[model samples]
Target: MNHDSYDDNYIRGILNGVKSIAMVGASPVNVRPSYFAFKYLAQRGYDMIPVNPGHVGKSLLGKPFVASLSDIGRPVDMIDIFRNSSHIMPVVDEALTLSPLPKVIWMQLGARDDAAAERAEAAGLKVVMNRCPKIEYGRLSSEISWMGVNSRTLSSKRAPIPTQGMRLSLNRTSVGGGATTASDRAAKNRSEPT
Candidate 1:
């Protein structure tokens, strides 16, 4: 529960477990951080809901925007807060009101509210502060290394470029920076010298 540095397993567990997410303060503008993060998660196969009172009529990545978390109409596994620290409490408060409360509350980069994190944790929700799930997902999947960022992992066996292209998955081996399916690992093992 150290808000300063998160263990990778803690993040990976949440990322791998959560299938649906509600992103509050999402922006449809492609230049905005929220836009790409939303796109990234959606691409990874998470059901992404965009929430912003200002853009209720618009859609991003084919998902309609809702005015608030309360309007999502479907249960989301996590609530990702893109709002400023000062505005986080209200979002956390609203999340606590959901019938089947979300399992996690994730505050994006540069956005943290210790008080909000505390309350959500009290309500049995896992709390992550000032971290972007997109970044976490990429780092855990070694997708960040594809962008030339060092992932601090090295391995003798490299993964094959999937015929489907570079879609990231949390299940990938962190060392190789490529998607590694069970069959891919089997192929690798078969090719290695005895």
Candidate 2:
């Protein structure tokens, strides 16, 4: 598959299908993009695991941070990398060693390694480079458009809800693998400042 320009369907599929994600190079600081991404994905229903050597045994959003992917001790459906381009290959190598290899290897924005991507794809894993899943999710789900961000998808009709009683559905269950009940949305609304 060409990594240069990915079709919307391919990105949507990965974001929809994956259940759990192990975020390599995650940071504890809230201001960092990775940290914001971690919080956002978790809010959107994906089980976001943080993997960072410095914060091993610590917690992020109530999920324990592991030193490495191998330390996760379970199958991770995807690996979202936040490291520099030059460091991607070793992370790919480590991802390959997992018992149930992740279905996808996603390199964060500004991070790309063609050789590593080729290697992972050769091993049968779907690869995405220089993209952020959180951004893709918001784009595909029309969240960005709703926020007036000019998502670039023009349609006369409002985007259809993926399911009944759901306003934005990206194919994953709400935050905890459950529907985004009215109360949940209400609480989120209350928490955000006016």
lDDT of 2 by residue, 85-162 (tens): 899999999999998899999999878888999999999999998888878787667676667753434344555645
lDDT of each: 0.81, 0.81
Tens digits of per-residue lDDT for model 1 on 1-194?
76665656677789989889999999989999999899888877788899999998989889999998889877889999999889999999999999889999999987778888999999899999777888888777777777996554454556555332244555544443333355346544644568
Query: Compared to the true structure, candidate 2 yields what TM-score?
Result: 0.81
Task: At residue 111, give the lDDT of candidate 2.
Answer: 81
Q: How do the predictions measure up, each by TM-score? A: 0.83, 0.81
Candidate 2, residue 110: CA error in Å? 0.3
Clashing pairs in 1: none
Relative to the true structure, candidate 1 reaches a TM of: 0.83
**Candidate 2: residue 148 lDDT (0-100):** 76
Compute the lDDT for candidate 1: 0.81
